[model samples]
Target: MADPRSQVEHEEEDGASAGELLIEACRRNNTDLLADVISSCGGEEKAAEVLNNTKTVLGNYIYHEAALRGNYEVIDMLLDQEGFECDPINTREGDTPLHSAIRFINSLPPTPPSPDNEPSAAYNLISMMLEAGSDASIRNKANLTAVQLLDPRNVELKRLFQEAAEEAEREREIAGLEAEEHEEEALEDDYAGSGSDSDFDPEEFKRQQEEKKKELAELKAAKAEA
Candidate 1:
């Protein structure tokens, strides 16, 4: 239960756009505020509904901001929405959320010797994006896939990303095959219905046959009477 007053205050005082509210909430790691704003939308919000689409003026998706700050909770909420796209590319670098996170990681200070103890936020963000079906194979304007942008020394991150990408690809292929099967079945049923009416015309054929039989019997009776 969000405080309606908070929403009112944010809207009236700050005049915050849904995208703004969502991005700010990600920066603050505030999932509640993010949920409140998204819930206000009718769930059919599109790019035309700019205020509620969770995209910035420059076409950066809310996930872009979340990735920069390692806000996984906000990322999770956005991904759960009906029309959420995990791999929306920012025009600046044609970078997806995964790309943004990779950039953030590249800008970080060198990892200490005990890197395992301090797991990278970028690693987690990459994993989440991949799991949510971000195409690992999509190249940015620089023609660099998310895997190509990885820090070479981060073997674990690359492996996890590659594995998730393969899994998503397999799922997509399976879904496509299922949809094709259903479409074929629908076409076969439609053809069967149409062909039965046109090719057979069973009722009309039966009526014509009955009329011919009656005529032949009448002729036989006439001959016998004569």
Candidate 2:
């Protein structure tokens, strides 16, 4: 059989369209070819537009194709593209690239124990996607989130997804709290600027100040008399 790498090289040399090159690069995990495709788009700004727009007839984006094939390097490169979306949904199942990655992982045989005790390649790839802001809470057309699609026997993978989900929730809560605090501060500032504090009266404040001065003056006069 002809070498797939050689075929991809041939296609590149033959001047395939940017979309075709991108699909091939993602499928083959050909980072060099993918880089060439991005450069062909003129620059990073335009590259993101082209990358996001390139999709298969099946309605899978380049990121989805890369994730489905477990193309780690290609996915990494795609994520770095300026303005590249981490959560583009495929047309068929409303599945994000993260969902596609889980599907690929589910198809694999259980990973053999590694001598070095390192994380499995699948684990690393999913972690990378999560770190890149792929929302695990996103549900596919089947009403299943990415974590829900994970093979139940894969306990370690499940833990990883759970931890990521928890971290995301914490970050969201922190953001919400911060937003509320800012709004409260803004309201207080507006109230102060508008002089609309119902409990505060300028006349009462002046009267209190005069009373303080009178008490001080009286004390000083009594000390002089003594």
Prediction-by-prediction clash tally? 0, 0
Top candidate when judged by TM-score against the true structure:
2
Q: Per-residue alpha-carbon lDDT of model 2 for 1-226, expressed as tens digits? A: 1111111222244667778888999999999999987887777766767777777878888889999999999999988877888888888999999999999999998887688878899889999999988889999999999989989998878989988876766566556655655665576567679979498665665575566556555555544553
> Whole-model Cα lDDT per candidate?
0.65, 0.79
Candidate 1 residue lDDT tens string, 11-61: 432576565776688777798987776667556453213322345556666
Q: Which stretches of candidate 2 lie over 4 Å from their true place?
A: 1-15, 113-117, 194-226
TM-score of 2: 0.78
Tell me each candidate's TM-score. 0.61, 0.78
lDDT of 2: 0.79
